[model samples]
Target: MYDNEYFVVDLGNCTTTGEIINNLSLALETLNHTGKSIVLKLNDNYLNQSQLLSIQSLITSYGCSLDTIETTNPETIAIVENMNIFVQKPIEKRVADKYDTQEEINSFQPFSMPKAEEKKDIIALKDVNNLHFEADLDALKRQQESIDISSDLKEAGINPKEDFHTIDYQVSSQYTRPQEVLNEADNFSKSDTAVFVQQNMSKAATMELEKEFENAEKNSIGVYKKAYDENNFQEDSWEEVDFYETATTSPVISDSKSTTYVNQTLRSGQILESEGNVVIIGDCHPGSEIRAIGDITVWGVLSGIAHAGMSGNTNAKIRALKMNAVQLRIGSCYSRRPDGTNIPYILRSSIFTPEEARVVDGEIMLFKINQN
Candidate 1:
């Protein structure tokens, strides 16, 4: 514990001011006696940014590297558009070096939506405010409950239970680059320390390492995908299916299911086919075709081609009173009877039937339209 003087210490009962002072004193004393130091730690989980930086300033006495720790939580949206780089920069250092003017950095994004609660992320790097209560989770919950739930939050699909608190976590300073440490390995052997860190690791180096690791992982995944894609083209256990030209979706031996066909004038050059009973109320115009695997009917004039029972069922029949239709069918076989009939032109309808048409005594016959 003495060697790990710069540990990420968790004061479990630091909610009281007295407890905060006691733990802070103990931690500082431990580090001072051991010839080690604690500089910075960051926690972004359960405390606001202002609260975190304030606590850091309250404890820090000697100005040191890794001394200032800042934190943030996952907000639903960013305050300013793509301002992450701003957060990484030092608070007091050159703003004019980065932006054209101080106004540019200070001025809020006017086009952006107003924040429901302004997050003041001010930190105290200079003096200490006698550490009042360190943290009160119950007080935090009560504060959260006091805020009225926004209608916009409801539209954003967040329930009342969802809340975020930004807190600070501490980290050690003796940062080093592995390459620099390797170069001084002989010197390290001369020294008594277990690990020899030659040079301080920069922030840019940490960012670069993170980026390279992501790239390597992504490339490995791409190589695996390419290998699978090359082999996936030729699938094993492939099967081929054969379908009829018109009845592509129907089975080889199909029966008519319960179905209905509505007001479509099956005009010339058009054909209607179904797997179930077909009903047509309009004219089946001449040269047009109507075929049903089960049964077919025409309420209006059937002055054209009509075929019933398409699936080789001779028991199915076609009956029309006008009988001027050029083609008819029961099952697989078609009937192409000419206009030369026993009845005259005007009486052709009477000769056939008034209404119902069906296959009777092995041939198509007609009865009244409503008789069936």
Candidate 2:
């Protein structure tokens, strides 16, 4: 909880340094911590000197000062002593002490169960009936007597005074015979030869439908090519549209190029560059940049700028589970998200369409790696 004067960050639930930093950063970003003092609460969670300094720096960045630290870890206390920050017992310990004091005070007080007279009064209240409820019941009886039951029965085609056994029930003649019996009789009347012919006709019809489906699948490739040609036409010939024609020399694809793997989320203002290839195991947020000489592959969403084939290796490509990059560059070619495209700053979705972007001829083209 935070107030105008102080903001308390409870890192006691976090078990790792990364979790602590991530939680602290999120709290700073989402809360109004400006010009206030901060109190960090930790429970038996160790923090080294560098980690404490980073936390201090992070607090200062939000225009807040680290005033006090409530921690149960001795290591954390030692680190805070040199940092000139006040230390105190954790909130959990303080709350436990308060409860203990209250219990001790309660022990000396006089208390007893309810007396017999008070118990009798409580039991008598449960047996008390409401006079208004009895009046409502009498009113309901008067209303029920006013309703004309004979008229309702006559309207429903029943004589109110007639015995139930004496009443006549007229049934439709068509439904006199049970439907199942009629069906069984009809099936028995059909000849065996006729039944065989009917089954053969149904089998032939099913086979014909299966053949049609097979034919449709075989011609799917031609249909896709026709649709592609109709929508991807340019004013100039496809061969003449060389956007990156200046790069005439091709760089050799080294067999031993090292690959770098990053396992943390790349926040804004973070830049990751690799000489060969770069693989990110997490999301690349907006305002971050990634440059690789060989290839770039993101296991998560790529919502930032990414440049592959920085040294003119046009063969290099960029791939991601969700391809929503702000700008994409491959070799000498540069491309950006189309104008008026609605790209969210942060994408959280259960469904992901893996896509790959590569230089096709002289233009960057995206291709779906899997069909839904």
Candidate 3:
């Protein structure tokens, strides 16, 4: 069988060196022998050093090495031994030993021409301990089912024991203490003592008063009134504005440019620029940069600098599964991560809250996309 890592070439039927050379050359030319080690089974064929050297060179030219040679001929064995190649008995001999009759041996085909359909015969190692464990468990289950505990208990009940015996027991009187101990107990009861009660209700009442005082302080500082006025004006407004709505319309009008897809991760110092929209399937590491004229999207983490709308389209947005970029740019506006918000790296997680960033009122603003 031709294993995935090794190939076998059987040339036992070829009687002459020229026939062997032709068969081997044809086999190598017809099949894919790249990066595979070749096992040559010569059987009774005899070849000298120069012929063997030519075969080795031919195998080498096809990017394959001659790993082992199987032959019963002494001359062929000697040639292979001198060339430092491993030698083994022909596979036919091994098969003959297994099967007694020549007809049976001829009928048995252990190997064939390397083809896609022959992959089913390729040997593979597997662990069978799980199978044995399951069998043992099944045997134990059968053993447990064979026993009938209820029936055995009933049989024991039917045959009662007659060795039982009963004995009478006397009750003892209560023990009494000495007269000096009684007098000490009476004196201890007559002593004066102080009692303390927990004031949990008072603490709760104090907390309520503190909360009221805080409300009063806020009212005196006029902060509550200012917030109330703001809310009241918003409620009375003719047109209600959504919190996520931009104050000004986006500058980008069309998205007719072709999109660019990047499948590999962009490491530090790497830069990717596209005239149209850009989509990255992997992470953009620190110090890397991505510039797109339309929009930018990252399926993975974006930790580098991302400039969307590089051609000054404010409507172009930068979206990422994890948005922790050092700097985000949209159109002519750019914003760095806020102070104290810098992190060396973000831990990978299956859960993600994808976010999108775009220029809003001359400032970059980010919004979380609802997965629902």
Report the Cα RMSD per candidate. 42.1, 35.2, 39.3
Q: Per-residue lDDT for 371 in model 3?
A: 14
lDDT string for model 3 (1-372, tens) is 333355678798998889999999899899876877788888888888999999999999998888778887756765676687766656545654776653453344333222334433222211333243345446756875797565565567742222111112111223232444333433433121100001211222244455455546321110000011222343555455544665465654553346776766788877887666787867788888887667889977788999887655678888887777888877666566643334333233223447888655565666654211
Error of 2 at 213 (Å): 62
Find the candidate with the highest lDDT and give its number.
2
lDDT of 3: 0.61
Q: Give me the runs in candidate 2 sitting further than 4 Å from their true place.
A: 1-256, 345-347, 370-372
Error of 1 at 44 (Å): 99
Residue-pair clashes per candidate, as listed? 16, 0, 0
Q: Against the hidden reference, what TM-scores do the models get?
A: 0.27, 0.32, 0.32
C-alpha local distance difference test of each model:
0.41, 0.62, 0.61
Q: Which ten residues in a row have the lowest lDDT in candidate 3?
A: 219-228
Give residue 294's lDDT in candidate 2 (0 to 100): 71
Could you tell me which residue pairs clash in candidate 3?
A: none
